[model samples]
Target: SSVMVELVGQMKDNLLLDFGEAKKIIKEVVNVFDHKFFINRKYLKQEDDSHFQIQFEGPKGMFELQVPKNTTYLLEGEATVENLSSEIIKLLAPKMPSNVEAVGVYIYEGYNKGSHIISNISR
Candidate 1:
């Protein structure tokens, strides 16, 4: 299994600026968590015309909880979903500008195709 996290933030006037900031923030977040999990890669993805996301992939076993659609399930052992989700928001909160709100953090898990596992949002 593999783990992925999508960082969503408010859009700015310049798309490049938003993307660049996202990249930098992602790097810092990944570095902090790297000690606990092995991150494979990080990339910027356009969620829609107005939203862009910074997404990163890491090895499995990093998350102990998995929620697909409506059901919630627990895995063997690792980081709890709530802990990781909150930690990510905490790491992002200080780095982000006031205008650029850290809207949501979505975590996914799977071997081939990722399934929406858990998420945390700050409005």
Candidate 2:
């Protein structure tokens, strides 16, 4: 049976200013959820043009998700950290197959917590 994933945002945007920093955070977030969620890193693949890639392996098989880097958005508004993991989860949940056994989400831990929240996926 597939499990449903839900994320309740608890913090404000502390968006990373550097692209490298942002990509690093996303990678860590993925590692966090890989275990119980059966999200194997070996199977994960990032987009050639962007770092925001979401990959998952389940009983039903593999799924990939990514949002093209919006340079225009970054240039217009100062890059502020957003709960990207939450955003991805919300976008992905409804589209996920019902047989997905686990759910994972990454939440920003506010500026005081760290540069970014540790990589994580929920089950």
lDDT of 2 at 33: 37
Question: Looking at model 2, which ten-residue stretch has the lowest summed lDDT?
Answer: 71-80
lDDT of 2 at 21: 49
> Where does candidate 1 stray beyond 4 Å?
1-11, 14-17, 37-78, 111-123
TM-score of 1: 0.45
lDDT of 2 by residue, 1-123 (tens): 112223332223442123464345445544443322222234445645554465656699987766444421111122223344444454454433333333355344454442222223333
Q: How well is each residue in 15-104 modelled by candidate 1, as lDDT tens digits? A: 423667667786787466544432212233323343333353458523322222222111233345544555666666666665554334
How many steric clashes between backbone atoms does each model show?
0, 12
What is the TM-score of each predicted model, taking all chains together? 0.45, 0.23
Score residue 87 of candidate 1 by CA lDDT.
62
Worst 10 residues of 1 by lDDT: 66-75
Runs in model 2 deviating more than 4 A are 1-82, 107-123
lDDT of 2 at 60: 90
